[model samples]
Target chain A: MRLPPILVYVLRRLAIGLVVLFGISAVAFSMAYLLPSDPVTSRYPDITNEQRAEMRRQMGLDQPLVVQYARYMESVFRGEFGRSFGTGNSVVQDLAQRIPATLELASFGIAFGVLVGIPLGLVAAVRRGKPTDHLVRVVNIAIQSVPAFWLGVVLIFLLYFQWRLVPSPIGRLSPMFISPPPVTGFLTIDALLAGKPDIAFAALRQLMLPALVLGLGVVSPLARITRSAMGESLGEDYVTFGRALGLRPRQVVLGDAFRGALVPIVTTLGFVVANVLAGAAIVETVFAWPGIGRYAVTAITTSDMAPVSTCILLIASSVAVTNLIVDLSYALIDPRIRHEYAR
Target chain B: MGEKLFEIQNLSIDTRRGGVTRRIVENMNLAVERGQIYGLVGESGSGKSISMMASVGLAAPGLLVRSGEVGFGGRRLPASDQKGLRGNLSHGVSLLFQNAKGALSPFLTTGRQVERVLAQRKVPKPARPKEITELFRLVGLNFADLGEKYPHQISGGQAQRVAMACAMASNPALLIADEPTTALDVTTERELLRFLTRICRERDMAIVLIAHNLSLVSEYCSGLSIMHAGQVVEEGALRSIFATPLHPYTKGLIAAVPDVDEPHELVPLEGSVWGGRNDIVRCRFSHRCPHVRARCEAGLPPAIARGGHQVHCVLYEGEAA
Candidate 1:
């Protein structure tokens, strides 16, 4: 009996992802361990050297490097990422509270980028060498070159400071409204599920600028990739064949050329998503958003090694998951690629 | 000869490259009669494919039809009327381009591709599946094994057959095949050509066979026009033209074809076709003609009629024999 090839491919990818996660965690932990600033000293600056040694013994940091690595792996296996010395909370617990905010921001950013970018690319490709094509390229380049942090600030100044078109970007919600109970930990969804449109709207309003800035930063590559791919696909003999068959221009471009152009776009989407997720840190810090990226910054600034390493591991895992999904979806969308999975 | 079904007269195509406009095809004429295989043979850049593309409105990007008139199904078609061309040609004319594998949408199954064209042509929903299966069979392919296969899954011959099936799905009256067998093996090419000939005879459909292979065209086509540098150098019945070749360029083309029965050294034609000479008033083929004369470069030569044949050359000034 033979197993389905797709399942085999998925399993192979899962095994590789697990290995990658393990490697990331080990390297992060090793780097943090070798850092000059000890976690005990950072947490308890006023304590004597004797007390510090006692604290190190209790925390098992006084052990050999191999033993410490084994102990760290044991804790990680148990879903424990140790405790943040600065905040005195479990790193996993802090991550659980903050990961949703990062996910929401990144998701919106990428969704906005893709939604706007693909259509613009199609238009640019079809109107190649025309004024519309030139306009789209210039806009795409401008959006890509503008730094997200700067864009966030400018947007804040115009929308919030000058025109007063939006609410203050104090955080996810105003002080007047308390957050809804965490269900999926995503504020907008949780608020909607809790039947509070006001809360959801406020959270969304606060999310708009940062996501927009990050999304616009990504739009250039998406649009450029889409345009080039579409242009090349349009030149393909199949497209000519489609047109010769007397199929409408709409069908030829959207149905045949678009699908042919999608493989490259989809491959690019994975990198874009990963970049968005990783890039959320700077945007979060600039906007004072309560996300894992902001939390990671705080941990790094305060020299909290556990939380920083934990954040690294989590991000690596997410990237791995994204790549797997992209790879699997590639097979699903294009049958030509699906055959490669057959074993 | 069958009734005249399609024609392209005074067809001139221009293309712009690096800010300079140039004529790629000029004052070309072709007429395809019903049930007749009309071969348009020329070397690579001689407008054989471009002329057919212009008739079907599938000319390569950036090519403009400067002046031409296409006649299809007794109706006159204005140049640049793409909408009219597409609508009129959809039912009557279908093209089979070179590189059968590339001609197919790689993502679609061969059956699905045929079904798409059938559906677009408004074949009844209930009959499409059966009709598609029958078409596959008509092209000597199995519906079950090959229908679900993508373009790359099939062999080159099978792919060409699949293309033929798709072309026939609309029951087109005219099939413009542009070097359809160039990419296949010799055996496969022969097989595909035989299939094309059978379809032409059985369905009474006119075909414009565009190819550089003179021998292949000689075997299949009844009437043909020889093109060089965007102009038709000779036009006539294939048998008559082969017997009494008039134009020097035409003679060179025949001499280049290798013969197994009476082996002779292949005499390759000297000089290359000038691609972008739109301003030249002389004959386009004069530079490459062995019988080049001072008068050949002075002005364009008129077509000298020889019975049912015609040759455009200064050497055939007033000879009627």
Candidate 2:
């Protein structure tokens, strides 16, 4: 009884996510192995066929595709991402070290997106027929259209080159600071917890440029969606009923109208997560923000098999996690969906 | 049924254009006594909903009252001051919309939706388990048998009954049931109407029953009005209006109702209720009137009264007669 409909829904989605992860792992493995370069020969030039064969036996590259896939899957199932062919370091360890910067940037980007976008949407909705809405419309369209890289370049040019207002772009911390203790593996929060407030601020400052570029794009569409949905919701009979119930303007907007408008708005955020994850590769390269994307880039350049496949599996899992979160949110946002999905 | 609830004096609604404002409902005067059901019957777009919604100061966003004075329970209501009438009055005066499915919040449980109106009154909250069970039972739901439920969990008739239960939550003095049975099936409609009429009698509450069916209005309402293009064309006691329809539109509407006493073919109305907003000076229904004449369009038609009944046709006037 404790495991009710929502729990069942979550379990079903997790199974589906696992299946998708397997598919991704297969594609990644095949692509990695199918590439022209061989790690044994490429890394060790003038290596004989006998030496390469021994290396192949140890790496299990001689095994059938299915057996190799099952073996890789078994290791990944046990939380072993295998060793990187390029660096000879465990892929899991590399990801653990790099993931903090990506999380900091991505989470901050989401925060700024919601903060800026929701207000613009409300403002546009309230001033619907006037020039204010029109201006907002134009701006929203413009913001979404502007590429993240271009925005990053423009902001970096204006902030760093012109005035030199921000900290150095070399790393997640300033020249003065040192690494904080790894707790949740997030540097900023870990810094704060370590009683290093200055280091936390420095980490935040480093993330600011990349966060702004990524966030501005996501925010524009959210604002547009909120405005349109609010306009529709405000006209519903129940909203009129809410008004008649003597609810104040603030109470009406927040309580009845906003919630009614939020269904579509929340759904849109799911797509945003997927887009941001994919777009992270570009943003990461631009800001030198180390994450899976930077790791994948290095793997691809040197044609590293095990690391690239493992990274692909991780990215696939993130996409699946994003979808699961979205599905869970639907039940919370509108119980009607939960009721239907329970069956 | 008790004492005076509201009085409408010279209520007029006009559709405003660039320079000229076209009159839709004109010189609509009526009164709703306390604990009484005042049925307002009309054809589609006859402005029954608009006139009543306006008379109670509840018009749609675009439609505005050009001139009117509404008195509720001895208190005068100015058109400009619409704020006071809501909630306190909304609690006192609940609106049962035409579409029950559309009225209740889809997200809320049927029981919570019912309890919501009660919550508005600043009353101490009732225990959820007891109140929801009782409310569901009152609305004729077998609360025990039904699996943990939401709005979509219930049937249509049950949903409407839930709507009624919600409306009754505030213990309202007046219920503006705007075609409350319009969306229900024949059997459900009859059952729901009977339930509503029963609630009105039991609670001693006033109801403004708006519908297109005159026979329905005649059955439930004590006193009633027939609307034509936003104007109150004819109004009096329900029995009197049925026995003797004074206005031409009222006569047409009565004639249009299929003879229930003896099964027969329906005599559809000769013409439609349209183009009234564009007319500068005329009885708007003149084009539709079988006995229409040049005199009907000469000016704004005068209302001729007899006892409690008022008819807005030129035939009763001295010169036209």
Candidate 3:
């Protein structure tokens, strides 16, 4: 039986992604293992040497490096990521509880970035050297230059403290409303599913500032990439031919130029999403959002090897998967790539 | 000859960069009679393409249409009024470009690209597929095999044919082909031009064939213009221009092309097309002309006309054809 070329390509990418994830896991394990502070010692500083030995043995940390790694891998395949010292709960459980919040925030951030960035880019490219183009470019630069945490704080101070225009930068929901049942882990979605509009609205309002901060960080790269790609596409012979053929200006620009510009824009968007998912730590901390970013930060500071390594693996996997998706999307957007893959 | 189908009169284009304005095309005039394959031949950057593009109101952003009037289908519109010209002449004018593959929307299938033009021409939705199939067949393409394929999936020759199909979708009265075969092979070039010539005659549509190769123009065009720097140095009936080449630049261009049966040393044109300064207002080809006289640099040489032929040269100022 022969596999289709697209299927083969996808399989190959998945295989590569798995190998990359494995490598990332090994690196994360090695770095954590080599840390100056011992996990057992740090967690139980006043324990006797004898007690520490027994604890290490119980945790399987007393084994050789290879044995410990093999055991950890075995447990990982069985969906066990050990326990978080700070929470005293299983790593998987902790992650399962917190992943939804991070995903919700990141989704909103990405949404904001794409919605604002792409149109701004299209306008700038169309208006090129005009005032609108200049304004968009300058604003993009300014947004990009500011740090995300600072932007988040500034927004909080202005929107929350100064004018009370938005909900306080407290958490994903107000004290008045309880979180809906965790059906799908996204508060907004779960609230909507439970037919609770007020809770969903509150969750969305709480998400605004942090998502905006995360989104502002994303906008510059997305807009700049989009602008340059769109500008180049607009200058292509097809655009001229389309216009000369008497196609409406809207049709020519959107249908011809925008389609040409999509490949790069999509690639950038994928990377931006992955970056936001992995590095929303500062934004999460500033907003007191209970997400993986804050979880990872705390885990890292506490030197809890299991949670820290898990977070690293999660970040690495997200990047690898995002890249794979982006690569696959190229074949959809461009016939050249599709033909190449078919061969 | 049929009636004049398209005419560009006194067309001048300027490019302003950092406060310095350079005249890229100056007082260009071209008239294409119905069913005529008119050649606008020049070296690269000699402003043939720019003049033709500006006439159709498709000039690039930096280019300014300083002065010109495009008369199409008996309706005259100023060249500077690009929106008006585009709106008015869109149905009557279509363009074919040098890079056919690049001129095609890569994302759209060949069939869809043609269909889009048909749709823009407001062909009813129900009749579009048949119209598209007919167009594909007209361009000698099999709709079943090549229609669904994107531009990159097809060969250069096939892509050019696809572009041709799209160009013909509008049933345009004039098709401006700007080096349409430059990117294709020699065989494809001849074949495409032959197809274009046949189409011109069959449909009674005028075509402005912009080319840099004099031999190609000589072979295909009924009438021709020889542009140097930014001005038309010589233009007339192709046979007459080839028979009695009056302008030195035209003679030089003809000499430059290699002939197989009549093998001769190719006399390469000495200087590039970039005329040093734009402010002088002299004959553009004065620096490159073999018989350059001091009077050549005095001012812009007037277009000396004799019979139907015209030449811009000091030597032709008093000569009778």
TM-scores for the candidates: 0.95, 0.87, 0.95
| Predicted candidate 2 versus true structure: per-residue lDDT over A177-286, tens digit per residue | 88798897677899999999988888888988888887886898799889989998877766665554433567567666787788788878778877777777788888
TM-score of candidate 2 chain A against the true chain A = 0.92
Give each candidate's interface RMSD in Å: 1.2, 2.5, 1.2
Worst 10 residues of 2 chain B by lDDT: B80-89
DockQ of each: 0.68, 0.34, 0.74
Positional deviation of residue A234's Cα in model 2 after best superposition, in angstroms: 3.7
- Which of the predicted structures, 2 or 3, would earn the higher TM-score when compared with the native? 3
| Candidate 3, chain B, TM-score (2 decimals) | 0.97
Off by over 4 Å in 2: A1-8, A33-79, A247-253, B1-3, B9-27, B54-58, B74-91, B126-148, B259-266, B275-280, B319-321
Q: Decide which is better by DockQ, 1 or 3.
A: 3
Candidate 1 lDDT over A65-153, as tens digits, reads 88998988998899888899777899977887888888888888888899999999999999998999999989988887788888888
Model 2 CA RMSD to the hidden true structure, in angstroms: 3.8
Please state the Cα-based DockQ of model 1 relative to the true two-chain complex: 0.68
lDDT of 3 by residue, A204-296 (tens): 999988988998878888899989999999999999999988999999998889988999999999889887986599999999999999999
Model 3, position A280, has a per-residue lDDT of: 90
